[model samples]
Target: MLDLPPDLPRLRTLRTWHEQCLREIDRAIAAAEEQARAEQQAQERRAAATPPPWMVGLQDITGTPEELHQGGCTMWAHRRRKTVTRDQARELLAAGIRACEFCKPDAELGFL
Candidate 1:
């Protein structure tokens, strides 16, 4: 006749160890997943708080409206009267130089 299982104690011990290992692995995976979620949330919060263009303390106020367009209209129609050529304005704006508050570079459509 064929021999049956020798001892059930060894089988129970093996099962217990296997179950313990599986539980530990599950805990580790859960912890990793939680950490990943936290990291992703933090990144999202940072992205939302930060500006789109990674600029410092300014909105993307690029270009101006067309209300001041005329043949003989004066340029730089803000509190301050600083005027620059279209090329110069483009260069300055491209260099991340914000418009002068008084002059209101963003309020000029001639350069646009």
Candidate 2:
């Protein structure tokens, strides 16, 4: 610990000034962080609005080139998705859709 001189008023004034300076520094740091966050959010929003080229069907889901084949029942090959689940596959097969042999919709074949 540091000891202050016997001047009580001067010591109090110094402490007050030190506290005020600390508050100002904190506020400046907070403002900078907020601006950075806002810019990052704006970039994200722009990216979401534009979307990628692969995404042609769903919101962000892309279709595979082999979707033209796989003649089965439900027409699963026609609809492309970002993530294909086991249940979705079954549903498509049950509906008369078939999986693409060349593209292999299950694996990473036609996925752009």
Candidate 3:
């Protein structure tokens, strides 16, 4: 609750006050939007700066590693994937797990 001044009895004065309030509200909205944009940009930067996992192990229905893919590979549509470390990826590739043709993790890890 705000204590409005009783002296603003004139229609012109009230209209002026209303315009000022609208301007203030617009300024506040603009400031909030700017802050939101800044925050979203910061979030995007953080996501971009964060590196993807080095490798991803594509698993079969049995939950066994079936293929190796580079971290950024999107060719495989199956959701049965697990993040793998460099060494793990190498071991899997060396164990004869087929590397994804789209994102050759084996070649990336010198397993080609």
Candidate 4:
């Protein structure tokens, strides 16, 4: 409970005080929204700068590694995929996993 000023003895003065409080609350809300927007932009920038280099597409039924793709490839249709390192992607390709025809991760990794 905030202590009101003892001098707000008139209705007009009380209404003015209420309006001032509301304006202060509005300012606080605006500041919070601005901060949230700035934080979200920073997070988006970070995500864009450090994307995974490779990914392994997985089989829907067995969850086994099915295809290799560059991290930015979108041609993979499987919902199950795993982020992998460049070396891991090469190893998986060498171990008989198929490379995505569209993305051609094997060629990208110099495997072909």
Error of 4 at 23 (Å): 8.8
Instruction: Please estimate how well model 4 matches the true structure, expressed as its whole-model Cα lDDT.
Output: 0.87
Question: What's model 3's lDDT at 98?
Answer: 86
Candidate 4 residue lDDT tens string, 32-109: 999999999999999887747898989989999989989888876446899999889889988999998998888889
lDDT head-to-head 1 vs 3, winner: 3
Query: What TM-score number comes out for model 3?
Result: 0.58
TM-score per candidate, chains pooled: 0.45, 0.44, 0.58, 0.60
Ten consecutive residues with minimal summed lDDT in candidate 1? 51-60
- lDDT for 24 in candidate 1 is 100
* Model 3 lDDT tens row, 1-112: 9655666566668779899999999999999999999999999999986645554555665788777777677765456777788888888877888888888777778886
Candidates, ranked, lDDT = 4, 3, 2, 1
Candidate 2 has its poorest 10 consecutive residues by lDDT at 51-60
lDDT of 2 by residue, 1-112 (tens): 8877679898999899999999999999999999999999999998776522221122224443233222232334346533334455444444545445454543432332
